[model samples]
Target: MNIPSLPPPVTRDKNALVLFSGGQDSTTCLAWALTHYNHVETVGFSYGQRHAVELEGRPRILEKLRQFSEKWNRRLGADHIVDLSLISHLSETAMTTEMEIRVMENGLPNTFVPGRNLMFLTAAAMLAYRRDLNTLVGGMCETDFSGYPDCRDDAVKALQVALNIGMDTRLALLTPLMWKNKKETWQMAFDLGGQKLIELIVSETHTCYIGEHNRLHEWGYGCGKCPACLLRKRGFMEYQSEKKPI
Candidate 1:
């Protein structure tokens, strides 16, 4: 999709911000930012959704990443979790409401939270503006997403433009996973560093809609039935298959 380009690249001196949820994709994006940017901070959102447990995992993920930074001699900035529970009250979908998951007439799943990504990017951009940061990173993947309109590259591009104009600041919003699938996402985390980053992602992140982390799987621990868990497991299987010796 042809979308608007971002603001000019900033100097390497400025910090980069990642819109973190401590989920699979976001974790990979965080690791990607850590590799490319010298200074990286994470910002999470608590919207009172059914899977709010993911928010709690943010710190754990950051802690593990910080340990990796120490070993790898990299620098990490502070992590912040913002309270946006009002967003939950604003939408009634499977993510925030007690309803069965189904595909809407527009081909979107019930888990689709209207403007969630838009709000997240906008909030992250504002935070970056105040912190004197020139880049914002996120993990929105349209290829392996649950039909979220906001996850589309075009949508994010439009929002990036709107945010720059509204905030009157030049910021580049980067989606490292924009063109990647779930399997590619796993490969990305591994390629960014090594197997240790992949292990941290599986052991420290949460992606289940039902918040089931006790059950173990090749990808991670999840309920094994929800959309998130299914996609993760499938990706892990594909990744393993590709890595197998013929």
Candidate 2:
């Protein structure tokens, strides 16, 4: 694999907690955290999403990462599942409710659960405080996304500042995929842990907004029509195209 130039390896004493959702981007972010941080923990949210199937794969993905290598097994730490069910009550978006996925008059996808990432980070920050983790990592991306304002880099950075000020602690918020599109994300997985990680991502992670897992596609098990599945599929195709012989 042709790996891109990456940031310097994190110091062994630096600890991080990843916001893992068992989706393609989050899973890749988990792997990225594992590759960089010394001690890495994970936190997932139970937001009553329509596609809650991703939650079921969280433990399995973590276990597989543990088994992938001795180093990862040693570095991986505790996992936290936060109950943010209030999000479902607050919003009737397609992500939180059973509704057709489409863009609203606001020109944003109805799948945008307002303040979801903000809340996720807030909860993750609280957990990190208790766990003494200083860095918080997420898969939020702006390069190839559904135009969700919360996923923007500025929002994440501002949140980090607010979190640190509110808690009176310096908590670094890291978004590895902030500028990277999906194809680069796939290449990142391959670079981080080789074909095994790519295989793990393709087979184990869930990204469909509809919770469809029985039917498998080249990218993974998804409805293949939803925005999430479409992005994953296109990224996988681009990634594979680059790998083919000229």
- Candidate whose lDDT is highest: 2
Writing each residue's lDDT as its tens digit, candidate 2 over 20-67 gives: 999999999999889888899999999899889999999999999999
State each model's CA lDDT, in order. Answer: 0.84, 0.90
Lowest lDDT 10-mer window, candidate 1? 66-75
Give per-model TM-scores: 0.94, 0.94
Where's the lowest-lDDT run of ten residues in candidate 2? 1-10
User: What total of clashing residue pairs does each candidate reach?
Assistant: 0, 0
Taking the tens digit of each residue's C-alpha lDDT, what string does model 1 give over 1-246? 687777666575856999889898888888888887778888999888887778878877787787775732366887887888998889888888777778899888889889998988888888888888889999888899788889999998888788888888788988899998888988888888688988887787889987777877778878888899989989988887897453
